[model samples]
Target: MAADTAKVDPMHQFAIEPLFGSDWTFAGHNIAFTNSALWMLIAGICLWIFMIGGMKREVVPGRWQMAVETMTGFIDDLLEANMGKEGRKYVPYVFTLFMFILFANLLGLIPLPLAMAGVHAFTFTSHFTVTGVLAIMTFAIVLTVGFWKHGLHFFSLFVPHGTPPLMIPLIFVIELISFLFRPFSLGLRLFVAMMSGHVLLEVLSSFVIDAANAGPGYGVLIGGPSFILMIAICALELLVAGIQAYVFALLTSLYINDAEHLH
Candidate 1:
C-alpha cells in the first residue's frame, strides 16, 4: 500500500525530462534533449539497419533480408489496398513514417527516459508537438504532390467540378474548413490515443498495488480483479500503439492522394 501511495502527479509524469538538463534551450521554448527526440533517433537507426542492411538480390534471402522484405511487402500491400497503383510512388515516405512511429511507440515501452511515449513535456509522442510536426511535413508532401501533378488546377480541389453555382460557396467553405483542420486532427488523434492509454495503465497499476495489501482475503480478492484489469489494459495499449502508428501513416497517404486526385 505504501508503494501505491507514492502516486506520481499525472501531469508531472507527462512532463518531458530534459535529456541534458537545462543546457539545451533554444529561444524561449525548453530546447532540452527530449525523450521523444531520442526515440526519433532510435527509429532512424532502426530503419537504416533494417532497410539498408537487409537489401539483397539473392534467390533465397538471408534471415534479415527476409524480415525486411516481409515488412516491405506488408506496406506495399497496404498501399495497394488503400491507395492503388499510384500509391507505389509514395512508398518511400510512407515506409519511413511507419517505421519512425512504430519504433517510437514500441521503444517507449522499454525502461529509459528516451522511451517516453506519451509524455506531456517537450517530448515528441507525449505532446501534440511531435505529431503536429509530422503532420505538417506529411501535409506539405501531399500538397506538393497534388499541385505538382495538377498545376494551378489544384485549387479546384475545394471547388467540386459539377456542383451547382448556388451550392458552391457552402461546399467550398466546408472543404476549406476540412483542409485547415487536417494537421490538427491528425496530430491530436495520435497524441490523444497514446496519452490516454498510458494514463489508464498508470492509474490501473496504482490501484492494483493498493488493493494487494488491504487485508488477507479481501486483498486477494481485490488484487485479483485489479491485476486482471491491468493486464487487459496493457494488452490493449500494445495493440493501440501499433494500430495508431499504421493509422497515422495511412491517413497521411490518403491526404496526399486526395490532393493529387482532387477527390
Candidate 2:
C-alpha cells in the first residue's frame, strides 16, 4: 500500500527541482538552475536543430526542407486569413510560438529519455507561471500594436461597430471585462489541459500497478484494461498537443487582427 501510494503522486511530476545544488542563489534569492529551465533549454536546442534544416536553401527541397516549408506556409496562411496582408510581419513570432509549444508538449509525452536517466521529463507548460508569462507576452503585444497603430481610437474596440448608442455603454463594460480575461484564460487553458491529462495518466497507471501486484487474475482484469486505456490516452495526448499549440497561435493572430483593424 505504501509503495502504491508513492507511485500515485501525479502532481509530483510537475514539481521543479534545481539541477544544481539547492544552495545556489543570487542576491539572496534562490536562482538555482532548475529542471524546468533545463527542459526549456532542451526544447530550444531541438527547435534550432529542426529549423536549421530548412536553411540550406537547396534548389530541390528535401524531406527536411519540405517539412519545414510546409509548417512555415501553414502559419503564414493562418495569419493571413486572420489578419490579411499586414499579417506577414507576424509570421516569425507566431511560428516560433507554435513550434515551441508543440515541441514542449510532444516532448513531455515521451518519457523514455528521462526514464533512462531515472527521472521523468518535465513539461514546463504544465506550470501556470510559464503559460501565464506566455499569455501576458501575447497580451502585451496586442496592446502595444493596438495603441501604436490606432492611438486612442483603439479604445473603440470595447464598443462594437453596430452597437446602438444607448446600448454602447453596457456593451462596452462587458467587452472590456472579457478583454481583460484573455491572458488569464489563455494561461489557464494550457496549464489545466496539460496538467489534467498528466494526472489522469498517472492515476490510471497506479491502478494498473496495484492490480498487477495483487495477482495474475487481477492483472488480467484491472491491469489489462488500465494499461490499454493508458495507451489510448497517450495517443490522444499527441493530438491534443498539436491542437493546443495551434489554438494558441490562432487566437494570438486573431487578437492581433482585432488590434490592427478594430471593429
lDDT of 1 at 248: 90
For model 1, residues 1-263, the per-residue Cα lDDT tens digits are 56555554445556665566567666766676665566677777867887875667678888888888887787888788778898898888888888788777766554345424533322257578788888989988877888888998887788877999999999989988899899999999988987887777667666665665555676578767877887888778778879988999889878977876786
> Which 10-residue window in model 2 sums to the lowest lDDT?
1-10
Computed on alpha carbons, the lDDT of every model, listed in order, comes to: 0.75, 0.90
Candidate 2 residue spans exceeding 4 A from truth: 1-6, 21-28, 113-117
Total clashing pairs in model 2: 0
Candidate 2 C-alpha lDDT tens digits along 214-257: 88999899999999999999999999899988999998999989
| TM agreement with the true structure for every prediction | 0.85, 0.95
